[model samples]
Target: MTKDLFGRHRAVLPDWLALYYEDPLEITHGEGRHVWDAAGNKYLDFFGGILTTMTAHALPEVTKAVSEQAGRIIHSSTLYLNRPMVELAERVAHVSGIPDARVFFTTSGTEANDTALLLATAHRRSNTILAMRNSYHGRSFSAVGITGNRGWSPTSLTPLQTLYVHGGVRTRGPYAHLDDRAFIDACVADLEDLLGHTRAPAALIAEPVQGVGGFTSPPDGLYAAFREVLHERGILWIADEVQTGWGRTGEHFWGWQAHGRSGPPDIVTFAKGIGNGMSIGGVIARAEIMNCLDANSISTFGGTQVTMAAGLANLSYLLEHDLQGNARRVGGLLIERLRGVAAQVPHVREVRGRGLMIGVELTRPGTDEAAPEAASTVLEEARAGGLLIGKGGGHSTSVLRIAPPMSLTVAEAEEGAAILDRALRSI
Candidate 1:
């Protein structure tokens, strides 16, 4: 059955679309933190569908809300008033931290980011953008153009003139040898130098925790320092929170809070995890920036009744349960366990991240050479042991990404870590 499905998929789907594992398993269904394959094999879900399942699999509140809303209506274009959409927007605006925030919903992170680009370019009257090195924004033409990661970017032709900046990867760049303070200072100085060489940019967009760039990030307060510089130049700051939003990081409600010493960002984009599995993405900005477009615009299926209902329900459940606090407690334990495991493995280059979003980079034993094969071996071993994980990096995808549901229990963390420890040992 699996072979037949694979054949059919290959015949129809785009070849560029990537899948995990030597033999990709078809996940049939899930509950809480576990999922069953088509062959009746069950495994613990750690990647959470690329971290989209923020709360849990088959969460009751989101399930019920989706069902009831579907019974009433699935969509009614953006022409009419949408109560659920309005409610979700209001909630997002209130929590966005941006004063006088206005929300615009989309169906995916790509579209949300595209909308942000439109706002920034139109408002600032500049097509230039500042994007961090080793960043992956999305797959859209405009997004790919701004992305600095070569593996993910298929074309250099873009609608915007993008300048790659330093500081995304803390340990692999020219400033890797510097301490935290010097690293931040060198990056800030680079930004200042880069700006002097180019025309004034519309905005500087970045991920607080770069999801596809091996879950890497600059030191805390780095962005705040950059914010100070950008503000002096009248540039807007856009935070792409698609993966780092909704308390996944544990220490703060939003990833940008780690750099909030300056102030709130001018705009924020979010998707993945907010709706638990529902297709929900959105952009929140100050009313002035959000309204800069004089012409009319609307998304055919964005903020439809059903997705909004699911998002609203999921958000409520997350807040009521204090999943952020749970993430803080359980994620800390999981990281410590994984750190201990890494110490025993020669190929484990670095273990980093915050809260539930952790990464384990693999390198050739006793060297800096990225060990993509070692990562693959550990991944296969973990799957055989009934555990699921993910891999990503700029250097041949040698980093293991572990992001379980924010509501993960301590026992589940221990169980997942044990399986991972054995998998790493097998390598």
Candidate 2:
């Protein structure tokens, strides 16, 4: 059944849509942190459906909320006021930290970011954008314009002008050998130089932690320093928290708070996990900027009743159970275990990231050459060992990405780490 479905998917879906594993998988059902495939094989889920399952698989609270909301009403569009939508917006704004925050909902992260770009350009009257290198925003035309990852970028044609910046990755760059303070200083200097040379950009968008670029990260407070410069010039700052938001990073509710010296970003776009698989995304901005557009705008299916209900329930559960703390405790142990195993493996070049978002970058022994084949081998081996993981990286996709649900347990972490250890050894 899985093989037939895989064949059908390839025949109909876009070729660019990639799938994992050699045999592929069809998940039939899930409970807690585990999922059963079509063949009735249970596996520890480490990817969490690309981190969209923020809470857990089949969380009862979210499920009940969605079912109840769906039974009453599902779609009313943005033409009318939605109680659940307004409720979720109030909750998100209260936590977003933007001054006089206003929330705009969208169906996905791509659209949420599109809305942010529109707001920035309209507010500042400039089309130029500054984005960090090795970043992946989305797949939309406007989003691809700002994307710095070459593999994910499909074309160069875009409506907006985009300039790439450095400092997203600290491992392999011109300033990799520098200390943390020096590195931040150099990056700030580079930003200053870029601004002096180019037309004034509308805003600078970045992921506090580069998600699709193999979970790479910059030094703490790098963006706070950048914020100091941009704020002086009236340039807006947009934090793409699609992957790092809602306490996934463990230390802060929003990833941008890692650079919290300057307060929150001008605009923040989030998705991936907020709805707990219900397909909800939105943008938050200061009311002044959010109201800058002359014409009205609305996402046709943005804040529907069912999805908002799921989001509200999921968010309540996240805070009530303190999943952020759980992520910190379990993810710390998981990273330590993986690092210990990587120490014995020659191909493991670096283990990086924080909290539940961890990355293991592979390279050829004694060289910096990326080993994508090694990553694939480890992925297949892990699946064979009853563990499901993910792979991502801009430089040849050689980084193993491990971002599980925030509710991950220590026992599951240990089991997944053991499987990864054996897989790395096998390769």
Candidate 3:
């Protein structure tokens, strides 16, 4: 049955779309952190559908909200005033931290980032953008144009003049050998130098924790340093929090808080996890920036009643349960466990990240060369051991990405760690 479904998927789905295991796993249902395959085999879910399941699977609040909203209305286009949309927007704006914040909804992160780009370029009167070295914003043309990672970017031809900036990844670059403070200084210096040689850029957009780039991030204060330089030149700062927002990072409610020494970002784009598996992405900015467009804009499917209701319920549950604090405590323990395991595994190069989002980079035994094949092996082994994980990175995709639901328990963390230990040993 699984083989037949896999064949059907490959026959129709895009060839570029990658699957996880040698034999693809089909999930039929899930509850809490566990999911069942079509064969009725249960597995602990650590990746959470690429971290979109913010709270947990089969979360009652979100399901009830979605069901009630769906019974009444699922979508009515942006032409009408949606009560749930307005309520969700109000809640998002309050938590956004931007002064006089306004919200614009979209169906996905790509559209959210696209709207941000439109606003930034129109407000600054330039199409040039500054992005981090190994960033992955979204898959749209505009979002992909600013992405600096080649593995995710397929084409270089784009309308936006983007300058790839240093300082996103702190482990493998020229400044990797430096201490945290010196590394921040070097990246800032490079940014200042880049500005001198280019046209006036509209904004510097970046992922606080690069999701597709192996969940990597720079020092906590690196973006604060960059903010100082960009603010001086009237350039905007757009935080792509699709993977790191709503307290998933544990340290802060938003990943930008780690770099908020100056202030909140000028524009913030968020997606995954907000709706707890429902499709909801949004951009938040101050009125001046959000209203820069001379003409009106609307997303027909964005902020439809059903999606907004799900987002509202998910956000409420997450905040009410203090999941951010849970993430901080649980994630700290999980990282320590993984670090101890990695110390004994030569192929495990590094373990980094905060909150629930963690990365274990695999490399050749004695060298810095990425071991993509090893990553694949570990993933397959983890699955065989009744656990589901994820893989990603900039260099041939060798990083083990582990982002469990924010509601993860200490026992589940221990169980997942044990499984990972066996998987790495199998490597």
- For candidate 3, lDDT tens digit of each residue in 181-277? 9999999999999999998899999999899999889999999999999999999999999999999999899999999999999999999899999
Off by over 4 Å in 3: none
Error of 3 at 180 (Å): 0.9
Q: Choose the strongest candidate by lDDT.
A: 3
Clashing pairs in 1: none
Q: All candidates' TM-scores?
A: 0.99, 0.99, 0.99
Per-model C-alpha lDDT, please?
0.94, 0.94, 0.95
Candidate 1 on 379-400: residue-level lDDT in tens? Answer: 9999999899998898779999
In the order shown, what is each candidate's alpha-carbon RMSD?
Answer: 0.6, 0.7, 0.7
Clashing pairs in 3: none
lDDT tens digits, residue span 1-427, model 2: 8999998999999988988988989999999999999999999999999989999999999999999999999999999989999999999999999879999999999999999999999999999999999999999999998999999999999999998888999988899999999999999999999999998999999999999999998999999999999999999999999999999998889999999898999999999899989889999999999999999766679999999999999999999999999888898999999999999999999999888999999999989899999999999999999999899898989999998899999889999999999999987
Query: Which 10 consecutive residues of model 2 have the lowest summed lDDT?
Result: 296-305
Displacement of residue 20 (Cα, Å) in model 3 is: 1.0
Clash numbers, per candidate: 0, 0, 0
